[model samples]
Target: MLGVLSAMLCCGAVSAQQHEVEMIPFGNMDQWIDRQIKESGIIGGATKNVYAIGPTATVTETKAYKNMGGSPWATSNVMARVAGITKTNTSVFPEKRGDGFCARMDTRMESVKVFGIVDITVLAAGSMFLGEVHEPIKGTKNPQKMLNSGIPFTKKPIAIQFDYKVKMSDREKRIRATGFSRITDVEGKDFPEVNLFLQKRWEDEKGNIYAKRVGTMVVRYYTTTDWHNNATYSIMYGDITGDPAYKAHMMRLQVEERYAVNSKGESVPIKEVAWGTEDDVPTHLLLQFTSSHGGAYIGSPGNSLWIDNVKLVY
Candidate 1:
């Protein structure tokens, strides 16, 4: 579902007609499968090694997952993995659109009463990414890496556009550190986000990693700013806005930060370059979307998001 052309041109003067590039197949939610979990084995009268099936989302034309080194995003069902003692769940389903369908994500909460009653809220989101899923390894921390080596992309895109809808709950909530110690505020407002990353990178003979970010585009809404249905948003190149942690990861590339140090031993600030420039050899292209703002931790339950008709206009 990745190609370049122009068909639906709007809102801008164009020298010639440009066809829209479909980066994700099944983006319209015309196809899906039921949620299934398999038991790998059993241990001491308890179910153990439960994992979700692969290829959750499909591309209508091309074999995107098999051909693209197992694309890491799941749309049909939220793939939640246990991190330490916390279990994360993000449930997704297909909702009827005008004629076809769109992906819908919902947030819910679960309570555990083993030692003491503890309520864990899960903010589900529809997401796609570049990585694999595996069980947490013993003696290892954060066994799964979020980003894998991305697919080969050489073209410079003008904008990333998509259709989305969001509905937030009215009840506000918060998470406490101990029983009554308030630490983080979990507000009623939630959001959906989309991102695109283009990079020129490679590895050395000594297994050292190196990369230069060529371009990126990010669109995120943390509040109930735009809650209309089928709202079209075209994120132009260089339109980057997010939290400081998100911005720092975009600037440093996360491969290595020491490489950007100046002569005074201070890290030099790296800026985001223009899109589609033929300055660096293109090595990777990563695109991801998420519906929840607090997937790293617990979030507000009952928040919902819908998305469809994603395109890359060039």
Candidate 2:
């Protein structure tokens, strides 16, 4: 029953539109979160289930064009054609400081003509400087955009993107960092929490740098969106450690666990959501959760997140 997608669903569960929606058995993250925080003396309320978390992005495939000559920094060394150090492709490609940085990739595996593309200059602080180019880029590196800045850890998982934000407001004296934690429960019993903390970080230098941060955004969870298909890029990932007071009660009882999904779009039990699902996704993956689903997210309105470090146990 570990990786099985078959769950006894709720016959009457409906969607937000009130149309009859399918409610699969929520993987037991609810009780898991409750049990984890039970001793904290906070009223652990049940929030809406999480859907997509991440491996924020994926590397499919690209073409191998000509390697021109500009950057002496990129492509200086060589090794396994599949993976190598960052600068290998920087010299020839269009670079924005560093547009797209990549390593340890297999273009053949991705089934593309090229390798990978990235916008590595995201980490740079100022407008007129070269940060770190992932591949050959054109023009000055433009700041990248993101669809979602996912959460850090959960019963599910997602790769935190550049747009993710952490905010502190007076409406409630809480600080919410997206994708910071996850919840899990089984048959109403809470599971042990596999927590993730924003343990480390480095500030970018004023000149061309490796990373950048916005005012309200948590620097740890996001990376600038400077990427292209078939190019390579390298960046860092980290977590955020803080608090956004949940409704009524908040405690550590919130633990996280996983349920497996099948080839079909079958639902997982325990009120969790799928943050990420795609053709590139492996056959087996965990049911992830996060605070990033802005409006209907559980607990506080703006206190939601997109979970990170997501993995399912077979």
* Candidate 1 all-Cα RMSD: 9.6
* Per-model RMSD to reference: 9.6, 24.7
Q: Model 2, 1-314: lDDT tens per residue?
A: 62231221111111223222221122111111110111111212212211111122221223221212221111111111222211211111111122322221100000111234321211111000011112222222121210111111222222211111122111222212212233211122111111121111111232211111100111121221222221111111121113221111211111222111222422222212221222122222112122211111112222212111111221
Per-residue CA lDDT of candidate 1, range 1-314, in tens?
12222322222113223555555554555555433333122211222222122333433321112223233344313223333342223356666887977666665543323344354332234455433333222212221232243456776765555677776656566332221233466654555566667766555454444556666555555555443433333333332333222354333344222222223433233222333334554666666666654443345555667666665666
Best-matching candidate per lDDT: 1
Please give the distance, in angstroms, between residue 271's alpha carbon in candidate 1 and its true position after superposition: 15
Lowest lDDT 10-mer window, candidate 1? 39-48
Report the alpha-carbon TM-score of model 1 versus the true structure.
0.58
Off by over 4 Å in 1: 1-19, 38-72, 75-88, 110-126, 135-149, 171-189, 206-208, 222-278
